[model samples]
Target: MPTQQEIELQAAAFRRLQKHLMEDRTDVQNIDMMNLAGFCRNCLSRWYAEAAAEKGIEIGKEEARELFYGMSMQEWKATYQTEATDDQQKAFKTAFKENVGQE
Candidate 1:
């Protein structure tokens, strides 16, 4: 098991990554991220929810999403999300199956 300091360091790194994605890189679309990297903001939010569950904190999906995005999902979509290109959409199908199949 990791020491308290190690866990804190990991948590700090996660916060930095979250800020980078949610605050610094709004241009990066979730669909594109899913297509290219097999995960996205939504995935991160879900992971957050899962983590909270593990800790017996009971955070729901929307709540987790709001915490991660620093805003509602709809607001983020309105402000930053764009239409995916045909190629991106196609790639998403394969990527989704490979990365998060049937989940």
Candidate 2:
């Protein structure tokens, strides 16, 4: 089992990464991010919702998405996202095949 301190440190690092994704990479499309990182903002939001459910907390998908996106998800889409090109879509399929169920 992991030590409490290690878990805390890991949680802190995850927070930093989440903040960077939310604040610094606002222009990066989630599809591109998933292609590169194997997980996108929506994946994070889903995991957040799952965690809440595990703890008997009721958080809707939209609530989790807003928490991760730092705005309404639709607002984020309208403001910073572009439709993925064919190449991006292809790369995403490859990435998902390589990364599925690893997290």
Query: What's the true lDDT of residue 98 in model 1?
Result: 93
lDDT of 2 by residue, 14-80 (tens): 8998988888877788898888889888888989899999999999989999987889988988888
What's each prediction's TM-score? 0.92, 0.80
* Candidate 2 off by > 4 Å: 93-103
The TM-score that candidate 1 achieves is: 0.92
Tens-place lDDT per residue, model 1, 1-103, is 9999999999999999999998898898898899878999888999999998999999988999999999998999899999888999889889888987874
RMSD of each: 1.2, 3.0
Screening candidate 1 with a backbone cut-off below 3 angstroms (N, C-alpha, C), the clashing residue pairs are none
Highest lDDT: which candidate?
1
Count the clashes in each prediction. Answer: 0, 0
Local distance difference test, each candidate: 0.91, 0.87
